[model samples]
Target: MAVMTSRFADGLAVGTNLVDTAEAAIRQALAGLSGPPDLVCFFICGDDPDDVGRAGQRAMAMVPGAHVIGCSATGVIGAGQGVELQPAVSAWAASLGDTKITTFALETLRADDRFVVVGLPERGSDDQVAILLADPYSFPTDAFIEHSSEALGSLPIIGGLANGLQGRGSVRLFADGEVHEEGAIGVVLGGPVSIGTVVSQGCRPIGPSMVVTRAEDNLLLELAGQPALARLEDIVSALDEDDRELVASGLQIGVAMDEYAERHERGDFLIRGVLGIDPEREAVAIGDVLEVGRTVRFQVRDAETADEDLYELLDAHVERTGRVDGALLFSCNGRGSAMFGSADHDALAVRDTLGPIGVAGFFAAGEVGPVGGHNHVHGFTASILVFSSQAAPAAGA
Candidate 1:
């Protein structure tokens, strides 16, 4: 059995006044803990940039001694519920005891024809974890994450793309009380803390896997020596009417992460969106780059499948870890009511299965988490960073 303590807590406030809502949420989160937390994370959703900035500052002031990092979001989740496309504030805090936390900011620059991500620190150790929040429009999150395997080694990087209602479409990133209009913000945690991750690409495979015979950087030209569009047409023709309707709405492609695996299962493939098709050239465009010889499968998603997928993954994590004390959930903005046609589906699932653990998160434009031991920017997915039983017990436990 796992012991529970007040080491971690979360709060959620919903209203039109952003600053007051932020303070209320922070107060609620701070109430359970004995003293100031070691780390504080917040997510705010609102239309006014000025209000969002002020609210972020107030939230930081409430926890003056802790390292703070967060960003504006389309929706905020906490207190066992999710607030979608509304004005809300969510706060999460942790008393990590002696854990070491370091905050950072990153920006991108273009050198000739290449895009370079600057401001990444050297990996501290083999056991550290990184939580990052980036502006989708300004930061090269995909490129930065693709190279993290080499740059940070085995250190797991988790978090997501911040979405804001700013007039210019740029997002706000918060680090240590200051709000940044561009780049990314994050914290690297080492020492007595451990974070376990679960990335649920809530889709089910629809047909047999096919080998990519020809591709051009996100465009699948041929599969098994046949035009990609032709293969897709055949697959769609064979599916039942309901399944075909799903494909017509939002089709997905799963790229096998390991080619040598004898069989690809649910967790074996990196799911990407099927952007569009080129009927003239008989090609299918996907969200990510595809190399020839990779196995690909057609996938479909719906509210029922998504709900089942998230709960199943959460159950597996609890089975392995024994308990989940707290968690940070980064779900894609495409989720929530947009996908599920209901509020709090993902957030409630976590609380219901994990047994009332503190959890907070936001509906990110794109979620970041490891798929097949590698980090990738994903869409229509839920990526959760779980602080397990390994967290140091509350101050005097």
Candidate 2:
């Protein structure tokens, strides 16, 4: 049987224009449905939190029975350059044929020993993949993933942390008609459905790999027996003026986790932001929690490097999937206009490389995708979930 899918988009001004625009968009999406939809994935963006909630409610009202899940974005993605500086909403509805959908939400996720995958009627022991969304501000995201891996027992988790404009104030997450804060939610797809994921790091390795001979929490004290900061300075000095300037603006470091092999490639490294440099101590602080005796490398980010890296990753995904019915993107909020100097760069790349498919997603605080067979929180990355229909089962089992 064919996997059925459809997509829709709506945009409006925030103050007085929200209701009208949202109503129109939701109606248009509902009208195009071939039949009743099983799931409705919505994306909303606005300057005000209240308007975002209103748009989410409008979407749920349009499709009462379908499972509604979405999060706020710094910018929303649609057919064109995403609706900017307005209360806008875009939604995609899917008629999941024989697929089982499971969803769960944990408010105090940090304290829980196990996470229950909700929405599915009964839990099965069979292998499953989870598409997760978390509020980065509340949960210790790293710990959550670690504990989830333990609880789920190697089940692959893919999705991103919901983000607001400029990474300050409150962010919004919607389920049904309600908006929540400081929580994580996800959908577990089991049965005949399968998910293909792609994580585009959008960066190229610049320097030689070094071993972390010494370190502390979130700080790299030494690399290859030399002070971490000293090594970073040496690498930056070797680069040309333009590249050096980019490094100085905001440098990043990648640490190879346990899953990666000795010979790591472009996407193998887990990228982390350089938090600060302690000139006196000669230590380098990173965004991630660190430990001693880890492998590390210095990396650079630029337009050319990012574009090349993204294209390469997407090209591989296209080759594997052959043809896709729909795509769900979890792109970093820092990447859109902040990195590309324009919007739709990441979405356009997916469309161009992966062929025309139903694409919908929101910009996230931290992008999520598997690297070296384990999921990690990433920045300046685009994580894609491609969906395709499965073959029908025998008539008489």
Candidate 3:
């Protein structure tokens, strides 16, 4: 008798040999599944491009009929642990009953002063989610995400930028069964399976939200009839000593995505860095462009704040949508031991709160996920894609 069921599993292995590590990880994941998976994704963390490519090829060969995709990272997360600065491989496999998977590779073309993304496939009506892995040095991820609505409609994207110690020319992306030196690779999944998204920017707002009275491009000229920098200074002066210390080290600006919302909270704003202040103009520069009438607030981040932010979101996910069948986590490379002073902080949180289920991912250069119904590339964030279990008719009933 034939059966139809959705299943997921993840595994991890660490060693000097990339191929051996990848094979062990894939085998560990495969052992947890009932049958062959429909899709397989692996993350390899190593410095050598040649070795990474070989390991990717071997992973593809191990799962011949399944769609394979992955990229090289500086660290990997799986098996309820995160391994950093080591040669490690993390593999995730899913047998999604009756789901359709389409994979494509995208490249960038320089036309005059602008770069255009080429090879974006037409999106289908049933397409629900897209998993994207791109090279930060070669791909214009920010621009692509900004225009994603025009190209792919409302489909949510969840993935991250591949990272390495040897920046720029060292990125390697894997799709189908091939390794790409430059460009981006992704897979679109459509079917009965349910996918949920979670994006935690790991920042907490510290001041009252104010509307922008004047602005020029990315420069904030005025806020609520006062100089932007001056307003910021006032806010900092009122904060307690700890918060003031946080602001002194580094500060961020959170731009409200929805202007009409009565209240602005943690997840409601898109956070940007407070780049530099122009004392002469009394203006503040941000990482993104801001328009007049937009609401903005000051934000601060630290180890304790980041931990609280992620765990709160994860708990909310469980309460609202039951337990997830599996999850793919894309955490900022700046996190892990650097932020928490301990290893496997994010990975353990996801597994302890929501898991014992399948979960795998890597520490990304930049995380990608939607905030307030819009996709954007973020830093110091943890972007996650959670899959719900699904069932369908037997294949040969």
User: Which candidate number maximizes lDDT?
Assistant: 3
Candidate 3's residue-wise lDDT over 307-382, tens digit each?
A: 9989998888777677577889999999999999866999889977786888899999998898878889999999
The C-alpha TM-scores of every prediction are 0.94, 0.86, 0.95
| Candidate 1, superposed: residue stretches over 4 Å from native | 1-5, 167-170, 391-397
Q: What local distance difference test score does each model get?
A: 0.85, 0.68, 0.87
- What number of clashing residue pairs does each candidate have, in the order they appear? 0, 1, 0
Cα-based lDDT at residue 265, candidate 2: 62
- Candidate order (lDDT): 3, 1, 2
Clashing pairs in 1: none
lDDT of 2 by residue, 1-397 (tens): 0122353222222333555655655554555556677776777776667776676677778788877777777766654244544566665666666667776665752237864433322445653567777778865667667566656656667788876654555577777667776577667777776557777777666678888888888888899999988888888888889888888777888877553576756776888889899998999999887666677788778878888888887777656556566767777777877888777788788778866555667777787777767777788888877774433211100
Q: Global lDDT for candidate 2? A: 0.68
Model 2 spans > 4 angstroms off: 1-16, 28-33, 109-123, 164-170, 257-262, 389-397
- Model 1 lDDT tens row, 273-350: 899999999999999887799999999999888899899988888777777778899998888898888668898889
User: Which 10 consecutive residues of model 2 have the lowest summed lDDT?
Assistant: 388-397
Instruction: Give model 1's clash tally.
Output: 0
lDDT of 3 at 185: 96
RMSD vs true structure, all candidates: 3.9, 5.1, 4.5
TM-score of 3: 0.95
